[model samples]
Target chain A: AQSVTQLDSHVSVSEGTPVLLRCNYSSSYSPSLFWYVQHPNKGLQLLLKYTSAATLVKGINGFEAEFKKSETSFHLTKPSAHMSDAAEYFCVVSVFNDYKLSFGAGTTVTVRA
Target chain B: GAGVSQSPRYKVAKRGQDVALRCDPISGHVSLFWYQQALGQGPEFLTYFQNEAQLDKSGLPSDRFFAERPEGSVSTLKIQRTQQEDSAVYLCASYWREDNNEQFFGPGTRLTVL
Candidate 1:
């Protein structure tokens, strides 16, 4: 039983301001975590993944996420928001036993001008 | 060179009609996955295939839903006696066997059972 929980359903941020989307997980083993972004009418694109490697994982488009084991969280962040960053973000977790992936409800990010 | 691809990007069906969706994984990929996504929700796993073998289908909603990847590359998902609750976006993803964890997704087949 692995599960992911995204704290925010929708988040709004100014174009030039910093952005953060929170996510937490519950897994029985050391889990592999991933962040995926999906633009409107488009497929999901991988942002980053943490596979028992680095705790701080950097991804495409200047985005990154920190895997905090003690806190049971993996929150995505970016220094500055861009209009193109507006999309749906999903936090996924895969357990060590199986390749099955568990996904959070998803967080919709809206970049304001 | 191409990513995972799916056919019939959008489809509308009558309540009792039968529909089939197809998927073509990236060349050489060994794993394929099928998921269903409802509005304002995350994708839910329906089935998985390793090569031509249908490995796991524990997430399938009912017996009416069936999937096959007989050739190890191309796959199809069929739904019989469709109901309104079956309306959702059906997503297909693929990954290499050695790297089965990170999957590349297709644009998905949007099915609307009316």
Candidate 2:
């Protein structure tokens, strides 16, 4: 079985400040991790994905995530926050060669001006 | 150039009524998926299709939910005798192929059952 846990339900950050959204995973096989962002009334957009490549992955909108197999964590981070970044973020996990993806509860990000 | 698209962006059905939601995946994509998302939660997988073949329906909540993709380009999810609990956003996603990890999502259809 594979699953993902998003640590924070909501996170607030001031503009230009760093942002961090934590996630942990449990999977029996080598896992593929991903971060997706959903704006209000919009579809989910893939921010980044890790497929056993480099431990550090960069994504769209200047976002990045580090895959730490030891910690069973893949936390998303951004050096600076912007107002447009406010949205719901989901942590997702799927095992290698598997099509089914397991999603986390999601974390709501609010960027302050 | 267009992404995954879904029709009937919003729908309302009375109890015991049947409803159908549609999805059109990206051109040439080989995999399509349906998911249900409740308020304030993440999307839950409902079913999966690979080129008109219904490969997985394990996530569907009940037998009342039926999905089909005849030509491999468009798919429909039909719900029978909808209940209030069925009210939620239904999302559709697609993968270019089995080897791809990224799945493009559609705007989703909001279903309200009264």
Candidate 3:
């Protein structure tokens, strides 16, 4: 019953510009939200997670995400883009008391020099 | 010390051949997971294990896919009669019970069935 939708399949941003990758979710209960990043030929790395705590969550590499329950959205953002930030990003939602996660299709970020 | 580890970083199997993949979780981790990721897509859960118990396998595609974590330390996923559709990256993840859903993933095995 829980699912996540990533709005953009691909996003391009110039270096030093702000970046936004939108995601939305549907869950029957209060859910745990997460953002993960995967580089080419690498494993997924956790960027951040929200477990009913503060609405705004900060993550590694100057990345952050805001959890908006009203909008059913948890969109990831960064103040400035860097070349190393280019990767595939996934939005995930996990139901309360459940260990399994439903992942979005993913957003590919490309940072331009 | 070490994060999750998976064997056979890449494999190419002929159709109808059986293949086995391996995973070694972090020391003393209580949960292990397997997922399949197609090209240009997010990873999809294939199965889950808590300790040595196979708790959930609802995401496995068919009866030909089998997974086991016999001693609670290492796990193996076996696929019988490989098909072209089965070609994808297989990922393994694990985390400690106290970590509260923080799953660390290994570099996945890229399987290509021809």
Candidate 4:
């Protein structure tokens, strides 16, 4: 019954500029959060995860996300966008004890020069 | 590759045809999952297996959809008399029990129903 809603369907950012992809969730219980990225013709890869240990979670490739309980958001951010960062990103939710995931619609990121 | 892998990376089936998709999880992974991804959308969970036991199949769309991991390593998702709505990318993921938080994904098998 839990789900994630991605605020932006597409995001465009210039190289070296900051990038933000928003996500919100609706869950009856406190849930673990994750961000996964899918590059062209490749499999989905884990970017980072928030498992209640930290509000701010750092991930691979200079990416990070913050879990805000008040806002019900776990928006992904990067200080400087790289050309390779252009890919489809998904916000995922998993409940305590149960590892099956619920995914957001996804946000397509495009990095320009 | 060290990552998960799915066979028949692309499959095209006529309506009412039966199709089977295969998934090879990373060696020693204890948990396996199946998901469906429609065009322009994120993948949706379909089923889960722990070792050789089928745990949760609540996400499966219909009874026509069937999945199995008899030996607990390789799994297959079979669709009987497929419909147009079944056209999507079938994704397979594997999770090592030690790393409970992350799931490694395979390059999904794109099933196209005509």
True contacts kept of each: 0.74, 0.79, 0.71, 0.74
DockQ-based class of model 4: medium
lDDT of 3 by residue, B14-62 (tens): 9999999999998999899999999988899999999999999999999
- DockQ agreement of candidate 1 with the native complex: 0.73
For all predicted structures, in order, the TM-scores are: 0.98, 0.99, 0.98, 0.97
The DockQ figures for the candidates are 0.73, 0.86, 0.70, 0.71
Model 1 scores a TM of 0.98
Among all windows of ten consecutive residues in candidate 2 chain A, which has the lowest summed lDDT? Answer: A96-105
Candidate 4 segments whose C-alpha is farther than 4 A from its true place: none
| Better model by TM-score: candidate 1 vs candidate 4 | 1
Which stretch of 10 consecutive residues in model 4 chain A shows the poorest summed lDDT? A94-103
Tens digit of lDDT per residue, candidate 4, span A8-103?
999999999999999999888989899999997789999999888989999999999999999999999999999999999999998877777899
Candidate 3, A66-105: lDDT as tens digits? 9999999999999999999999999999986688878899
> Model 2 over residues A1-113: C-alpha lDDT tens digits?
99999999999999999999999999999999999999988999999999999999999999999999999999999999999999999999999889998999999999999
C-alpha positional error of residue B110 in candidate 2 after TM-score superposition, expressed in Å = 0.7
> Which lDDT value does model 3 have at A60?
98
TM-score: model 4 vs. ground truth: 0.97
Q: Highest DockQ, which number?
A: 2
Q: Candidate 2, TM-score vs. the true structure? A: 0.99
**Model 2: runs farther than 4 Å from truth?**
none
